[model samples]
Target chain A: MGKKVLIIDDSSTMRKIVTRSLRQAGLDFDTILEAGDGQEALQLLAKESVDIILSDINMPNMDGIEFLRQKSANAAIKSIPVVMITTEAGADILAEAKSLGAKGSIKKPFTPEQVSEVLGGLM
Target chain B: MSWETHIADATVEIFSTMLMMEVSSQPPLTERIKSHQDSVTGMVGMAGLYKGMLAIHAPSQVAMTITGNFLGLEVDSVNDDVKDAMGELANMLAGSIKAKLSDNSKDIQLSIPSAVCGDSYSLDYQPQQGSSMVPFESAGGRFLVELQLEQQT
Candidate 1:
């Protein structure tokens, strides 16, 4: 079975773009789910089984760092790998995300090659 | 590269690679008027080692074109897609620049992006440290990206 990927971002346009890029990067995934924010993503995680997550840092209800913190503490979903895709280019933000157990990160305006490289061996 | 070069590179990269539009940026301007009667403004705030704002302003028609290209749809008006796309563009630009500025230290925090659209409006920004505006032309339409930075007090 192919991997099940989940994408979380506030912008629907971004979600579409990331989805397209994932496919272009040659990651075979049977299911690709999406959420508008961390809260919505948690809701989806409770009801579904996702293998990997691609998330955005800044969001309305709950941000990616908080989501990572919550997910890290939950045994039911703690093992899933999260890759942050965001425009928050600060080193502090990146360190926080890493401390919260983010497996990797890809900055905004990324290319397919970069996505593929980051997802290497993770998927 | 300088901050202005970074902004120009990010703008060109985003539009060319993601939106598949060719962007031509003019020389950076130290002083310029940004607001327009019918324009879309996307803004993102930064706080930490540096505090200021980054914004992208484009005429409504230009914004619609960019949004349409981003979403692969035919956009004709200022809708949610236009606002969201512009905000995301600003977010991306801010992040890219922040990364360049924060290479050695972890001292930047980015705020969530916000967008506004109007038929007529004015923006009054008094930068305490530094600021620049760069105009870009793409697909026959023009837009401007502005960056302002100041040391946090």
Candidate 2:
């Protein structure tokens, strides 16, 4: 079976950028899914199965931290690994995300090499 | 160094890394330019330990060029994509400034990003503490990045 990936962010522009970056990084996924926010991502998760997830920390409705919290509680989607791609680079928030079972992170204004370096192992 | 240095470094880094464009920062402006014409302004607010706003103002054509570089497409108008791209730039710039202000992420809270655009408009802000506006030159044109900050007790 081909691998699938999910990307969650509030900005449609950012979603498109992430999709482009993924292609540039050579991280090929047979299927690529998108969600506007954590709530939307959770709803999408209930219906679709993805091997990994890339998300943004700040968003409307449901942020990434809360999404991680909610995703952990659901047995069906708990196992899917999540990597945050956000403007936030503070130790506190990133640490909290790590505690919540995030696999890794890629900071905003990041390069394709940075994306590949962090997500290469996760994939 | 100073806030000016931070703003310059952050803006340059973002444009270079994300936009794949090189931008050179000019000396800081002595006075803030409140009124804009044929331009788009993207901004974000910060509150808590420090209260402030970070904004990026660009001409319509320059903004379209930026959006084009960002998405690898030709954007001829200042549409939703231009607004979102500019807002995201402000968000990223604010995040960099926030990191410099405090180590704790909760120490400061950032509002959702917003954008304004038109043939003519003015942003009215009376900052109680400090303010700085830096101009940058890109291949397409020039833009300004403004920071208005006041430390809270």
Candidate 3:
């Protein structure tokens, strides 16, 4: 896997936890980026290249769904895999995310093992 | 959905999924959990369809343990991890109750969950036109999630 990750979430707590888990899972990356919302994430994406995107579905300003939608529309950013991390497991949101081209999803309250398991396939 | 059922489901799910622990709500004789001098809790209150507050109250020790386990950190102090987990749990429980109680939640909205924890605390919530208190307990500590739903109908 390449050595860059983009973490997009409104919650700083969640962002830190995911970053810790990423390290614990042994996914060494030279660069790890943070964005509070999809709009900020898109802005970061425009300026840099990242191998993977870890995002949350619910956020203020712009949610992950809108982020994925806009990213999918843009050919330049479409190929990067976006993995969703969320507490919401409703079928509708899951279907919508997948249809929008999300590579995978990890539900909230997740464990280190679960994080590793999901990221293994993508990374 | 009644307060009894909501409390039962929320406690069960949170323990089962988050902590990887199983807890059985003891009888009424079970102690009502009140944390130590300074502690933290996350709460989310609903005002529309349901007029109630859901809170996750835990002692500093318990909060640290829960946070460390959830975040995979060797945490020693109560931080954002504890606050967010408690707040998020309230959100999940409320959402679950909403899904169970209503056909559509277009009319109902939820306030964001927040944290409040300290040595001295007092909450004077005048009983809504009609509302009830629903408490939840996990293996480590106990917290109460109340429901005052005379508005949903």
Q: How would you encode candidate 1's per-residue C-alpha lDDT over B4-44 as one tens digit per residue?
A: 78889989988887898999889987666855779999889
Docking class of 1: medium
| DockQ-better candidate, 1 vs 3 | 1
Deviation from native of the Cα of residue B79 in model 3, angstroms: 4.2
Which fraction of the native contacts appears in each prediction?
A: 0.67, 0.75, 0.13
Error of 2 at B113 (Å): 0.9
For each of the candidates, give the backbone clash count. 1, 0, 1
TM-scores, chain B, all models? 0.93, 0.98, 0.77
DockQ of candidate 1 compared with the true complex: 0.60
Who is ahead in DockQ, 2 or 3?
A: 2
Ranking by DockQ: 2, 1, 3
Choose the strongest candidate by lDDT. Answer: 2
Off by over 4 Å in 3: A20-30, B1-6, B20-24, B28-37, B45-53, B72-81, B95-110, B124-140, B145-151
In candidate 1 chain A, where is summed lDDT lowest over 10 consecutive residues? Answer: A86-95
What does candidate 1's lDDT look like per residue over A1-123, in tens digits? 677999999988899899888889998889999999999999999999999999998898999999999999999999999999987756677798999989999988888889999998697
Off by over 4 Å in 1: A90-92, B104-106
Q: Would you list the rank order by TM-score, best first?
A: 2, 1, 3
When 2 and 3 are scored with TM-score, the better candidate is 2
Taking all chains together, the TM-score of candidate 1 against the true structure is 0.91
TM-score between candidate 3 chain A and the true chain A: 0.96
